[model samples]
Target: MESLNKNQLALLTCVIALSFSETAQASATALSPSSPGTPYSQLSNKVMAISNERIDKQLNQEINKVNDVMATRVLAKIGDFSSY
Candidate 1:
């Protein structure tokens, strides 16, 4: 396989993702709706199912948890290094 540059890869990925999402949405009324069962649609559907407020709340909580952990580790390291 040929190597693709970062920008080309990113653009290609986005294009493919968009295609699958559009196809899945179009196949919503199909008898099988198999594409919707794929990870792409499952994630899209999950996101669509929830409200924007809930998404923001979850994102904020995740960010807070990450920041808290990082702060705790940094403080611990600084204290340990300073006492040596």
Candidate 2:
């Protein structure tokens, strides 16, 4: 095998060091108490709450739309100039 040039050697050393550092960090994180499940549960609850609020908002919007349509139809039927 050909000997590596100085720059290539330096680059290879940096890559290996970074790989080991990443592995060590991953191991450290895995050993911590914060697992994925707890955060997922919290996130799921938040999503559900947001979804419910959006649904309620949509229902209110539909109700208002219907009310406006009915009001316009009533106004069209009563076409006199001054009865207020």
Candidate 3:
């Protein structure tokens, strides 16, 4: 098999490291709810519910980013095979 050049190897390493870091960060963030001491703390229960809803929305966005990356990778493999 042909070896990767330095630039190609570096780019691959960087992409892998970034993916790992993003997965780790999302996992960590998913473990905790938004802190009560922030502006959400000062609001009534109804407003606090809205704030929590927003937090959930943001969490879903992060999760979607991870999913999108995985989907892109799968599609790339499919494209590679179909090109033959």
TM-score on alpha carbons, each prediction: 0.41, 0.43, 0.39
Alpha carbon deviation, residue 48, candidate 2 (Å): 1.6
Q: Judged by TM-score, which candidate is best? A: 2
Single out the weakest 10-residue window by summed lDDT for candidate 3: 1-10
lDDT of 3 by residue, 30-81 (tens): 4345654545334445454444555555556655765687699899999999
Q: Summarize candidate 2's per-residue lDDT along 1-84 as a digit string, tens digits.
A: 143255445655555555555545554555456665657566556555555555455556655765687688779768654565
Q: Count the backbone clashes (under 3 Å) in each candidate.
A: 0, 0, 0
Ten-residue stretch with the least lDDT total in model 2: 1-10
lDDT of 1 by residue, 26-80 (tens): 4453424554455666655654554344445554665576568769989999999
On the 0 to 100 scale, the lDDT of residue 80 in model 3 is 100
- Report clash pairs, candidate 3: none
- Rank ordering of all candidates by TM-score, starting from the highest: 2, 1, 3
Model 1: which residue pairs collide? none
User: After superposition, which runs of candidate 1 have C-alpha atoms over 4 Å from their true positions?
Assistant: 1-50
Cα error of candidate 3 at position 9, Å: 27
